[model samples]
Target: MFTPPPSPFPSKSSELSELEMTHDTPTHANPSAFPTHSCQSKQKYTLALRWTIILVPITLIAIGVSTRLFIHPTSFDALSPNSIHEWKTWSKSLTDWSLHERHKPTENSPWLAIVPGTNASPVIKRSTLSATPAPTVPINPTLPTPFPQPYDTTLSPNFSTTSCYNFFLNMTQTDALRSCRPFSLLLTRSQAFIQNQDDINATNIDIWGTCNTDLSSSQCDLNMAWFTSSLRSSCATDLSNQNAMAVSALIGLQAFDLMRQAACSVDPVANAYCYVEAVASSDASSYYFYQLPLGQALPQITSGACNSCTKSLMSMYSAALSSANATSLTGLQATYGDAATKLNNVCGSPYAQTSTVASSSAPPSVDLTSVGGTWAVLLAVGVLSTSMSS
Candidate 1:
């Protein structure tokens, strides 16, 4: 049987060598060729796929970054606040602003203004709004009186679009850049974490009775606590891992301080409404937020008439200046005074005067770390309860 196979046919070992030769000399080179794997087709495709997915995007980014700078406070086109581009744009802006000595907050500042051992009482009284205005209206001797015009009852213009997004959009350069801008800018960087829209509108912060606190007392402090505490379960829980909050993080005691200092108070309830109205008005008119610095931005927002909203607007800086004088919170008076002076020209005097004390210190940084139920921790540092940040 074994001898029969040796006739006219090669042995198994010989066949193996022929097959090896076939592999060595591919089909292109040898006429009598079997299927040649080359074991390279898959590899080439894999490499090409990798480059397309990885290199193409990287190359595009590299080219995009070629002529542009990374950290300078360069001017950028104004984008819609609720858009992803807007979120990242401001986030980059915040990173840029965070670098400046003038723009930074006090190191490790206790952003909260509430007294220890205090419990929160509800400030969201929808029926009424007032800040306990002074008996005599002497903010401007020239202007008839502080409340010269009747209270704009139907204040804070409404918008069809809604979200807790642009809470600080209307924030003046003094307010926004001072305490909340850094956090607001964080929205810009947050898109990486959320491929979808993570933005909330500035006016969306216009929740009814949310800011109904009297800066004159611990009412504002407790209200802030309540707000942050509420965020703990909702937005904060969802975004806690990021250690930041959403972009519109102006929901701290700092807001209360602003109302106290700048806002013309009719009563505690009305005071909150005043602050809201002013913010809503400012946010409504995107007139001032076009990549402009304080020099430009200040006048843009305050350019409106000398209404109660504008009155508080002027007081924000001047009141801060007075507080800085008393508290010796250095490096603040100059900044606050400059804004106040400019606002004085726009609005008037006595509004920024110490007589209407907005606060006793520079507005601390509003952390905006979370919202809903996760806000307490962030509010502890001056932020959203869980504006579950970007």
Candidate 2:
């Protein structure tokens, strides 16, 4: 060890004790007395925390603002409850119709059954519906007495030109008859009828729920009554004397009438008739032939096979043939005679059945496989359809 000259300093133990006290105990006024990396580290951490506090809310606000500006209302509305429910309803209706299952398979009410006790034809009451009687429609001076027959079913000529058909159109569309609903729907629906008479399966005038109680209360009752009455009149059915519009008019009017009669059920839904279906195909076909074209074409109409309520229906329609025989209107007779034979061969016959389709018992419930943890694909379908139809 090197020898040192000692004078001002105390012994090593006393000097070490004072030095330790100085380093261990810090003073506020002498804060910088000892240089410290620990203080620097704490300062850096505080700065980082302050910046995090300031930036976090700002980052969240920016994201929210960006989403509001960028996203569309319709894109967001796909998630709405109304859009989801409405889309499902229409989809279910279409599926049920196409599958030949007209009625929901609700357990059939026993009284509604047209079985052995009811046997269909005898128990039903006569239709309360009747058309207002009108005289023969005459040609106006604006046109020739015998106008040329136009072949197109779709012509809605100017009112002045349609002298013969104008009277009926007036009953439905004139401002005086606003209750008939504007646009003269009968005029348009008649055109539609001529196009798809075969595809039509129901005579439901109650589509809007406005006319369910009785046809007379319907907004278009006067028009409907007149349209039905005019076509069945002996004069309107005469092929020898009328124009082509008359031909088209009668075709559509009779279609509307037939459906009106079918839909004017004493019961709810078309299913009371649809319940004519059976577990076996052969027996099912046997029950309802009286209403089909072939059955109607027969010189003497007859149906006893199932003797179901459709038999009663065929009986009510049979009254039309009696009028037809008196009027000598064979065409109208055929149209009226087949009211029991359902559209799409749904009731109890194979006349309208085709190979491409197989019957289903009921429509399927709305369902979809979850994908990527999302709701049913119908949400996407509803979204797409909303984009187009809404």
Candidate 3:
């Protein structure tokens, strides 16, 4: 462009002023020579934020870890020295008592006698008494006899005649009567099953006025109602699924031998007929129930009593018999609820109110399992840590 002579360059003052204005405006300033104070402040703030993020997470993690260590059972203070010493002493006492009991002989066994006079049934085995006896009154020959006496009959000068019953009666003079009652320890179900037979006989007597004939007889059916009513009144508590299962199992076992007798009986009644058919049809597996006594049904629910060998044996036995399948276990657990409840009633609380957690407190090896999940959990945590670190 044809222009007049180029305008003179801006004066130095104007140029300097323009440069100062440009520097004042943001983005036009140089950062190398002197950084602004605000920039330093921002840098410090960013560093502080980074430090806070790192420190807060570390503190939280430390607190969480400390809390776990404080409350866990593996912590040092859980089983203190005094508690440990007390436990040891208690355990030793139990062991000594057990040894002493083992060495002692069973006082009542071998022979059983029922004497109507004292309302006492003494079972004597090898002439020993297991229980204490009530005080006995001294016999007074001076006092007149309350009842008539039999005439003394002497066969000969040196010999006397005594009946067999009298001879047996005299035997008690030399023998020590057993005082403790005999009961099945782990074999309660089997024993109770036998008792059920006696109950049935009693039922039969009440219904038909005797157990010798079938209920088809005129009076037999009439007695059935009374028999059932008596059973309801006296044994309503005993006629539970637990008792039924035990009885059924025994009956199923005896089916092979009793089928013919049951079928050929002269006067088989409706109930007897049903029982016979059930026995004949049942298989060995019929007794194989899914729910077993195991951990809950037979645990030590009483605090007052020492550790029981019988209970431990029953628990182990039941556990061995338990089904492996979860579904079966669940069903069996449910079915045992009633029996468990009865047991709880027998062993009143706070002992009866046992926690399943206590049962789980035993080592994993106690369950007789080779592979526990603890190792698997540790391995999983290790892999997670490695991935997170990477």
My TM-score estimates for the predictions, one after another, are: 0.29, 0.28, 0.16
List the global CA lDDT of all models: 0.31, 0.34, 0.28
> Which stretches of model 1 miss by more than 4 angstroms?
1-19, 22-49, 57-251, 260-274, 279-308, 324-390
Q: What is the alpha-carbon lDDT for the whole of candidate 1?
A: 0.31
Residue-level lDDT tens digits of model 1 in 1-390: 455444577889999998998668564666545454554566666665655565445433432332122222222111112222666665565444222111111223222111111012111111112222222222222211111111112223232222222231322222212222121122122222111111112222211112221132354345444443444433452334432232122222223344334333332434433433433332322212211111122222345545554454444444544554323322233134434444456656654553433332333333222212212222332322222221
Worst 10 residues of 2 by lDDT: 117-126
Task: Order the numbered candidates by TM-score, best leading.
Answer: 1, 2, 3
TM-score-superior candidate, 1 or 2: 1
Residue 217 miss distance in model 2 (angstroms): 6.7
Q: What local lDDT does model 3 show for residue 18?
A: 97
Better-scoring candidate (TM-score), 1 or 3: 1
Q: For candidate 3, give the lDDT of residue 283.
A: 22
> How many residue pairs in model 2 have overlapping backbones?
4
Model 3 residue 123 CA deviation (Å) reads 47
Residue-level lDDT of model 3, residues 32-73, one tens digit each, is: 767579887777777666665655555434322332223221
Candidate 3 lDDT for residue 69: 25
lDDT of 3 at 179: 10
